[model samples]
Target: PSEYFKGMLSRVGYAIFFIPFFITYVGHGFFSPGWLLCPGFYLLFLIGLSLPTALLNKKLVGTSLVFTGLLSGVIVFYQVNKLSWLSWHKPQRQILQIIEDVGTSQTKTLQIFDCMAAEKNATSIYRVVGYSSSIQEIFWLNHKVLPEIQILPCSEAGRSVASLTPNIIKLRWSFPEFTVLTH
Candidate 1:
């Protein structure tokens, strides 16, 4: 790359590094997996910039190789076992399983109370950017169209359930815990 091109790339790298901060200021403070791409690009930029210097010293080359190998190993391990380590994934999966178990042909709609509230209070890392609704997160995770699921506030649960038909299933959600209500 020419000097101008290298300078432009460096500037781009700095811009990429500050993306999360800009996003946080402009939008909801939710960090999603897509934000990771920025850091990945910055890492590549750094590695590319340092490659020439690293190649000049045999010891530095060896150290860089070792570090790269270690980083690769850690990344592979995380990818392989991410489901177990990601705290929110298990509960989300379990919630889906529960819904699957209880859902049937006769079930027309599924209503979850306090879901939005729970999501707002949640400290989960796996949040969908720009949405504070667990319903969106669930949809993103499953990538499937769920039954007509409505998220209602806890205060409206009684009123909503009272007006519900027999075909609708009501569920009370308090973060990791779920209660299926039988009418």
Candidate 2:
């Protein structure tokens, strides 16, 4: 009973110490969901270590773990490489490129606004596109608020939205079902 109690205490202590270190190492600087999934690797390592290699064939255990690790690495590499193949399917990248081209052609600073509810994603998207825009849902040019290009859903533009504000100069571009408006 004392031996079991001691084992339990040691396990609790190890858990308290190891979990934080493992989390920090896997997460590095940010708590990525992909990083969180990395603990599965540790599970494999534990299983490999706990398999009684002395009772079972040591050669088999070592070879299987080595092969599993290599296969895991190859799978990760393939998945990462597959993202490039999927890049063209992302419409946000297309919109970003269009904004850049239009801004350069017209010699206007690329400033954009999207749905107010998506403000956080919009800001991150702008950051990724290498442009900055102020937040204002009302598509109006205010010298004090800074001139901005408004990015609206196609549905919003089709409703003859110009009637909402009389003096607004809204230049809109429609691509397939998606559209953006610049004012």
Candidate 3:
């Protein structure tokens, strides 16, 4: 058992460096549930797999190590700078614009609902809100208490929910794909 463990570690030992990030990401999720599938987790997994393959090939280990180091450095720099390449994508930008129009305050909590609930492993709307605002807390309306603000996809159901909801003033933003409801 000890030999087998050692053999396994010898090939993929570099993965140990990613454990802390994975733990931090998981911890963050508990406080702010978001993307069901984290890209960072998969990136680490691929790096681990590549590490072992590079080691087995012998000729690639040094080059792979250098490339990995550069990649990690770039990622660290981007994170430290608070740059988000993925956040600016079209769908994300649309959602973010709606979140921005809803506005936020340090003390308020926001809740969002959408077709995301229909997907098996849906990304939490809170995550999208978090990226665009400084609101302290956000939740999904999926089996949770209704919050002051609700966001839904621009659908008939969304319009009906907005119209039926009390104490909410529907915002007049033309988000061709989403609806914003607020108090």
Candidate 4:
């Protein structure tokens, strides 16, 4: 079990070393609720795989620390300098494209998420996708500007539900025609 623990730690030690985690979550607006669980199971799996080989040689034990340390240093370097390789230009273009695709300049009912984990957030306007139970249920929301809204069950409820932690508002799959606001 000791070797298993160390081996698992070693793999995490490497992933922690790589992955520009800060950029993906904060800058790009990415969110997955159970993301932390991925590593927990992966840790167990790594132990099962690595222990056999590590037990045969004592040197792999030392290697884990070295890999961990080396990656840590690199990650810190990128963060401190504010040097992210992601293209900021790409997202702006995408947002414009979405607007063009949605058409009619609808009054987007924007929802806010606690993306920064901060209190007292502000409202962000979004093109209304319509009131639905899920992603596919786009009916009145499609054509209407600021159409009738539905509070998703799995999401935060009530009016302030928009200010909680979600990027896209779930619309009902059965919705049909919608109104658009004139500029």
Best by TM-score: 1
Total backbone collisions for each predicted model:
0, 1, 0, 17
lDDT string for model 3 (82-124, tens) is 4232442544555545444542333143444445444312234
Cα error, candidate 3, residue 54 (Å) = 14
- Which residue pairs collide, candidate 3? none
Error of 2 at 8 (Å): 13
Per-candidate Cα lDDT values, in order, are 0.56, 0.42, 0.44, 0.37
Tens digit of per-residue lDDT, candidate 2, span 101-137: 4422233333233332342332233322323342231
lDDT of 3 at 162: 47
Ranking by lDDT: 1, 3, 2, 4
Best-first order by TM-score:
1, 2, 3, 4
lDDT accuracy of residue 47 in candidate 3: 48
Candidate 1 residue-wise lDDT, 93-152, digit = tens: 656676556535566566777654543553332241112255545544554544566766
- Cα deviation in Å at residue 20, candidate 2? 8.0
Model 3 scores what on Cα lDDT? 0.44
TM-score pick, better of 1 and 4: 1
